[model samples]
Target: MPETTLPRPRRLLLLSVSAGAGHGRAADALHAAAVAEHGAEALHLDVMDYVPAAFRKLYTDFYLRLVEKFPSLWAQLYRITDETPPDAAMARLRRALERLNTRSLRQAIADFAPDAIVCTHFLPAEVLAREQLRVRLHCPVHVQVTDFDLHALWVVPGLAGYFAASDEVAARMRARGLDPSRIHVCGIPIMPAFAQTLDRATCAAEAGLDPQRPILLLMGGGAGVGALDDAARSLLRIEADFQLVALAGRNEDMLARLRTLAAEHPRRLFPQGFTRTIERLMRCADLAIGKPGGLTTSECLAMGLPLLVFAPIPGQEERNCDYLLENGAGLKAVDAVALEYRVRALLADAPRLQRLRDSAVRLGRPHAARDVLRQVFANG
Candidate 1:
């Protein structure tokens, strides 16, 4: 057989770790976007699979422990990184990464020589930026800041562009000396599934929720850490006839606990474990109660679901909560009792919920994945 010399197929590698479900979710969205543009044959890799098992375990476990057990320490660490100037720490971290476990990463990048690199998480982005420093890898490094705020970790020394989650984030990047041209102001990337699903009535019925009662969907991302029990308690105090669907997200214990408490009032509350059908759930929901994780917020916005913020982490989540509150996409709670008051007021006032729905729909960029693909492929 004649050797076909049409050049090896161009590939796009999606580098992400399961540090949290949010990062992997973003990677999945970007990978789908890339594949939509270049075809599935050109797609390769799930970075979580490429790293050493022990290191992967450590990476995921450390973050889980920090968020679960010692959130104050996590907050302090986040604030320290958050306050670092763009010029100082990113470069320092870039240089410090010369000794990273780049054997697999480098070979993958070298073999694929990907037309571009899209990063949904910070660590892989840092590793790639430093790999460029170490070996001068030629592809453009496109960093997708998966949250609504800018973290210093996302500010790689030589990134070609940042597809930010919001305009507020773009402004912060500019303040730190990033050129406007390098910022795309693209809303956070979401799974094409979100873009495709459009069955509000059907989803509501299937979830065993009332079509007439105002529906509250509660979540706290993958770890399921929030004042959920308190939030549910507040909802009950509000005297809302609303049906609630609480996503307890990998917190099996939390889900089980909620299940037992909620069984007495099955018509009023539903507690679910880690789920992939969030897009469907969001469409059926009337309001949301949770911390504002970026991807979760994005999915909620895409469905025009208003949020009621109860317990946002001190750093990124605080920033997300600010964005929603500033834009009227949601409201914040001062504490458990106060949170209940807010829920009662909002749920009782149909006009207020409608206005929030309008705000959320306005804030949503359903075609963000298209914009990301356009930017990435336009370079190649």
Candidate 2:
């Protein structure tokens, strides 16, 4: 008779950056999934936190300002970065920037010595690739492409695998010279809470929402960018009786203003300021109206909630919106007037709403977290 022992559980290091919150949140979701489903010891760190404070501040501030005020410039930079060849001057500049700015990042990776590394942002992947080239770092690395569109920056030659949000992205990676076999077609990983089924009536009541009325959930991403007030006001113009759940994340002034607006208006408006119950709120919502960031759109799809995409930032958000519209999973409205029309029309057409909902369900990868964990270990 013989007995066998299982191999030691893998320690997964999930790296992210807080540039816009989606990267860090995606890392968190993957970490939670690894621990709960695979019993893996996982650590999630914001790569920006390890970098020098001044560098972190400059990087984040520049990114926010560029995307907010100079969207066309952001789009141009995105294209330049994406199209840069490996040996081009742009590539040399990126490598130099990583070396000059990310000493702490290299140290963090060396200290952790994880069995596997998952990068939710491209910066970490590039830094790790450089470190691996310079040292004996041999841990398997996998990249979870945060957006549906595959940017060239996310592709570094030595990675073990690439997890993409859709097959189209996988194909794009292949076109960009990535090996097809190394690419996986898993959607972006989201928190497991979005996968669970909860009673809509109970969730609605807990959030102080009326179960009988149609619920429209509006958001402006984590930074609370975009015209939240105008969007809400325009949606309110709909003659149909409906409830609004406005999530003004960390924008206290917006929250206060929304509260005042709710007080002055007759329609029921639930103003929230950065709450953790987004999964619950999505469950209680008939439609999700917001900018189509990678994470927000993924969360909505995970909850089987149809999307009414508002004005998206010109680069990645625009790419994400294109994916949703192309897949028949969402509708886009570029202005307040268009937003109002989309909301009213979708509300009035039950069949169209159902079709969008079905498309969302079909496209959603509720088990994406587990799928990613499985793919990582299998490839390793």
Candidate 3:
């Protein structure tokens, strides 16, 4: 009998943008899962890095500034963009500008020659789709929608497939004329750590939290744009027997303020800076109070931690909150008072909290990253 040899692992190219944390995190999750679980060679790149400095700053910084300083205005822009047809004159002009700025990305993609390409952000997918219109791409290109909502910008015409965060998003893609077979609703991909079975007591002890008391985890998104200090102070004032863990991600000023508050509250409040052990802290949490960013929400759900969304930014975060509320996995608080009230109520009502946790566990897709990899490489 002739000897049989195994096939080489598939090469994957995962592209994302630095406009915000969720997309990059999603790409990173897919990359980690591909290499660790499937033994595939993976390369991840920030699309902004291939563009000109001026464009990169304008693209990323402008979005951050808009979302932080003028959320209402950002919301308006988001609505307008979402409502605009992809083939509209303004949309075409914007896509043309994006393609012009991302010429170098084409060369980078050609150099890698990946067997499959997955984009967690729409920009790289749009660029590649345009390139395919001009020249044939040998590899399959798929766009993963990181948010629960699908925007028109993500509906690029020429692509192999789309990975949606939910079935609703997949339906939106279908309404946009996408082939049903190409849309995969696999939830948002999260880090493998979230899928692990971690002991809550051990995790709580690691974070210096008491497992005997309820733990409320509060966080802004990666940039830490929320007024976490005020929220923490409000949460501290609640007449409850629970610990609050506030994570200020990469925001030095917010972290300092949090530490100062922790000093005042002593063992009751814990302030954390950007940490890689988020999965552990999440495991310790009884409830999470944060803006429902896609990746963060997915992480919370994966951990079976119920969310209490606070003043979600008007577009995607708001939609994400709605999804949680509809699915009974989370609650929403439109103001600080509401947030405090909701937290107090949920903590006081143990059965309700347990129900929320049960719903979250039911909705969680811990193996979404692996599912994505398997689906994309099934034929390969």
Per-residue lDDT tens digits of candidate 1, residues 238-355? 6657888888888888888889879777688788888878888888888888878888788878878898887677778788899999999999986887777888888778998999
Quote each prediction's TM-score. 0.90, 0.96, 0.97
Clashes of each: 0, 0, 0
lDDT of 3 by residue, 1-380 (tens): 99999887889999999998999999999999999988999999999989999999999999988888899999999999999987789988988889899888888888988999999988889888867777767788898899889888889776888899888999999999988988899999999999999999999999998999999999887777789999999999999899999989899999999999999998899998889989999998999999899999899999999999988888999999999999999999889889889988998999999999999999898888999988888745
Stretches of model 3 off by over 4 angstroms after superposition: 1-7
Give per-residue lDDT, candidate 2, residue 52.
78
Error of 3 at 206 (Å): 0.5
Residue 107 C-alpha lDDT in model 2: 77
Off by over 4 Å in 2: 1-8
Candidate 1: the clashing residue pairs are none
lDDT of 2 by residue, 1-380 (tens): 68898888889999998888889889999999989988988999988888778878877888999988998999999888877887998688867887788887777877887999999998888877877787657898889999989888888877889999999989999988887888889899999999999889999999888888999999977767776877787778788889998989999889888888889665567888898879999998999999888998899999999888887888788999998898889999978888888988988998999999999998998888889889898866
**Deviation from truth (RMSD, Å), model 2:** 2.2
Q: Evaluate model 3: give its TM-score.
A: 0.97
